[model samples]
Target: MADTAAEAEEKFIAEAKTRVSFVRQTGDALSRDTTVTQLVERMITHLRATVDDPDSPVRPQTIDRYENTVAILRGDYAGGKYPTIGDYPLSEVTEDLVHEWLWDVSVIGPSMGAQCRSAMLRAFDLAKDRGVRLWPVNPAKEAKLKRAPRHIARALTVEERERIIGNVTAWQTPRKRTDLLSIVRMLADTGMRPGEALALRWEDVDLTGAKATVTVSGTVVELKGKRADGKGIRRQPFGKSDAAYRTLTLSSEATTRLLERRVSASSYLVFPNDVGGVLSLRNIGTRWRKARGAEFDGVTLYDLRRTVATELDRKYGPAAAAAQLGHTSPAITGRHYIERATVVGDFTDALGTLR
Candidate 1:
């Protein structure tokens, strides 16, 4: 019986050693970059190194997002079967092929389509920087996005705004409802984008000065499913235009509304989530829809921004309005807002004067 037990133990030890050897062999194979697949593998190795480096700002979540995007791109090339990156030639990527790839997925929503294009663009950019002739030209730069149609900006009518605010005030759970109303009022008064509004921290707002400056400094945003993995977030100014980044003087009403909200003294976020983190744009949008009720159509959170801009144009001259809205040129303001009925009102009254 002792000899039989000893034989079984010896067999288990041998099998364990064999398994370890097999694992070691696989690791060794993955480590070498002898072919195109190896080069692709190298990209992942570089990404992982970047993600793991303590000094690097790239978060693990961001790295995961990039990895998933790369996996999708690679999987498409591997005949639907997962293969090592070394299996494919890096030189075969061309602008035409990328265009086709984008078109193939064009049925998806614009936001998602844009994200996929952006991901592929980043990969090609990395390859180009490394002196790899993978793509003839960056497809993202060359690919033509369909022009978005022009639509009239929807601002809340005076009656509608009153009704919505009244309804929100009467809600039993007025926490989110009140917050949305405040946000809408702020947007309508300040002409800030939904992203910019959500990104605002309490420190950024100077209540005494009644001025809010939106600079590209310290604004953290999750780009393409990427999250801030303990690395300090990158701050991007409101917009590229000098006017976009400038400080704006807030109205008394705006200042009053901000002060009314019970925010934590330690909480930096101006518009935080329930847990005092950054508010999700999706949640804000959903809540806004509910607040407006069934009668509201075509009105979006963005429309509050338009409303502010239009009001500014009416109160101030075109140039002043453009400056307030952070537009570099009056041309854009005119094209987007000034020409719209919501901004200019009915021109039919002017026709009678001409007659």
Candidate 2:
């Protein structure tokens, strides 16, 4: 697998398996049924070139996802994995082929394998429209992916959260890098994503009236650049879904901190660099790592959101927790954000019973 290795290559398939597994129909020529039209049709072409509708163009993210799925399914183009699979006729493709390919990908993780399966289904739907009916049913649809153990959101204790923020508070004004700590606190207070916190503006925050709320309307998204996709930045609503664009009630701590650090009307972004430009997420992360050091290695900005979400779940229940986190469903929040380790019963009642 590499330049130097001490171990033998682990073989997945047995040499003398009774049932047929992977069949390489190399150099197989398609029967000339409709001259030029039949020769050009392929899964790769539909994914890369074919437009979904006359009016609505395919989303750029869709293209990126399909390309990745194609790489995993058909393998590399310039010779690697199983390059020849791309050339296989849509009519020749089968469920067994997709299952085996996805099985290979499952080694990475179940989520990845599941996503690949869905991508293949989309590609094959294009094939269906093209009249390339392999079997009576769509082959890609048959591929099943079992759910693996997913990593739940990591939450910090109240002391851990305070201690980290306390460290950040030491750095004073005019110092630009110290802004990372403020952003960290904002994430904890509002449960806004790191990018959302970075993309925040002074106008979005309301420091007056009976209630203080920050309108989380936009987030920093990296779209398709000149080189590749998902590279450029833009302040856009609905970074992931319609639910992402939401208004969150700022905690008293958050309100106080934000009020102190509110920039002038001339500057728009709440957390800008020295030149009033947006600070990059990576740079902020580096500062956070240094602030936490070895004591909080695994904790992240998302974990700060997790901490807030856990408290939300405790106080208000799942619905409130989901709304605050901009989750479309309570299930996602319930699955990831809700901490399972703590006791849930009435503590006062339990104390009385203990007495």
Candidate 3:
């Protein structure tokens, strides 16, 4: 009887061990299902949802920057290309991991690198708040390298501006020529960013008052990848830069040109493509290049805005210019409008009172 009892006890112990092994195997399978890619996707969705919540301190733009960084990581992973982080687990993310990631590979430019670093830092911060024990430190803070200086605003010179305008008129297609000219003139006159100008609809224009306002509250920005609901385009709204959202007055010529362009209106856009869709920045650059025959050295569509700001400063004082240009303060106006000694010298002479 004793021998039989001992044998029974041994068999029971063996069965318990088998059950424990099976449980561990099931847990391992579950863990395998939650990949780094899956974790990142969930984290991004969660972050975006929380961005506008009153409890969240992060701004919308801040969230965008983070989303863009994760997108880059996702691309690298899917393409079998390695970012600085390689195939490390997201749960093991740390400042040291980020540091290695930034300097590890040479796929990104300096500006992009800095942007990615900023985005990652925000993501880690969000993760910490969400009770994720992943990152012990903010890698961006620990990074020793200084990012490149902010791009200097390049405004067209008076001569260059005239050349660009002249070239716009020389286009073979009258409608195309008119559209390009109108866009250039409006930007130069009003100091509005290209995106802001493109976002304008006919309803936004107040020709009767000779003024227009850019309602940055819900301005659309185009994005790539799968559409929301797998249908149509994806666009997002402008963030909380007060200067980015403001009213602008039109020059008499600009108002007249807009009025003239309205005759062919098939759409609400003040500057629409031939198909009557929103004018794209890429198309603008292409047309501008074709019109000028020669690209303006170091100038972009944004330079038109800078040119307007500089012109405003020359016509009025710096403070007045700042207000007209929708700058946050006079200091910003002075910093951007005050060009090199040679450029400022010409403006000074032009604005100088006859003594």
Candidate 4:
């Protein structure tokens, strides 16, 4: 009886081990079967739900950039859709395939390709960290991409600035409006973003003190689904960054312009559309393009801000420019806005000693 009981016990233990092994194999298979598409969707959901900076909510531009990245990955960018490797199971995606795809996508735009690669890198890492390591290695970890081209800011010369101002003024003459001219002058004088300048309300400006000042409180942004056509635009009641919320002492010229506009202002906004509603940034850009035409090729409204930064950096220093531009770091102002050592101190005297 004792021998029979021992034999039965041993058989039961063997069966239990077999069941555990089967369960583990099933789990591994399930994890391996999770497709790239599935992971990307989950990753995007997480991005939409969470905020990295508690002080600042994610901006619409950030969401738009992610959407663009996904569009490229799914082969839905530009127009027609094509079957891509995004549908493949995580375990089946090879590093070489990712490398080649990244290189090919760079043809669209180096920055776009970089953004796509960044998203993929995060997706794969998130999966590997949280779920099972479906693959022995993260495929995106080793994938290489072409370096993006460096874009140096072009600061407008005084002559160019005058010509542009004249061009825009003449362009608006037929329309019998000075809205674009006001905005151009404001942008040139204050170094504020076009969106920030457009979002200004009468209450945000204080012209009563010894020095006039404008509060940088909010900015105009495009929204995805608040209109009948599934697109909306409105002012987000916060600046793009913490540094963006500043009280800027307006220049005398800017203050004078505002005083005049305030007297004739029809709406609460410092700048508004014909319908007394928030102006669409896209429309403003279109109008700007039409007004400037070939006469101001490659010159953009944002360049006016850059011109301010360059002039401020030259006159004072990078810190002043950063403060004016609402940048948190002087490094940012120096790197992107100020021209790179275009006017260095006369080093000839120092080098003369070597001679």
Best by lDDT: 4
When summed lDDT is taken over every stretch of 10 residues in candidate 2, the lowest stretch is 18-27
How much lDDT does candidate 3 score?
0.60
Query: Per-candidate TM vs. native?
Result: 0.62, 0.72, 0.70, 0.79
lDDT of 1 by residue, 1-355 (tens): 2369889899777756754553354353222223433443444555565655656544444454545445545566335443223244455545765666565444333443454565556655555544455445764567644434567655556676677666655542644422666666667677777667777777677765535333322333444433454433333333434556656677777776776653434467776666667666667777777766676655777666666667777788678777776778977876775535535667898888996
Q: What's the lDDT for residue 110 in model 4?
A: 74
Q: Can you write out model 3's per-residue Cα lDDT over 1-355, one digit (the tens) per residue?
A: 2379889899777756754553353332113234444444444565555666766666554555555456567665335344644245655556666677765422445656676666556545544443455444654567644455666655678898898878777874755533787777777777776666676777767767536343432343554444544222212344335666566666677777777878878877777767776666777777777776566644677677777777767777777767766668888877765343444435667567665
Global local distance difference test of model 4: 0.77
Residue-pair clashes, model 2? 0
| Residue range 163-257, candidate 2, lDDT tens digits | 88876665434555446777777888888888888888888888895768888876775544542442555555444667988888877877777
Model 3 sits at a Cα RMSD from the real structure of 11.7
Judged by TM-score relative to the true structure, which candidate is superior, 3 or 4?
A: 4
Q: CA lDDT of each candidate?
A: 0.57, 0.65, 0.60, 0.77
Q: Order the candidates by lDDT, highest first — what do you get? A: 4, 2, 3, 1
Instruction: State each candidate's clash count.
Output: 11, 0, 1, 0
Report the C-alpha displacement of residue 28, candidate 1, in angstroms.
Answer: 12
Q: Best-fitting candidate, measured by TM-score? A: 4
Off by over 4 Å in 4: 1-30, 50-57, 79-84, 94-96, 135-144, 174-178, 228-231, 341-355
Instruction: Output the lDDT of residue 172, model 2.
Output: 35
Task: Please identify which of the two predictions, 1 or 2, would achieve the higher TM-score against the true structure.
Answer: 2
Task: Provide the lowest-lDDT 10-residue window in model 4.
Answer: 21-30
| Root mean square deviation (Cα) for candidate 4 | 8.8
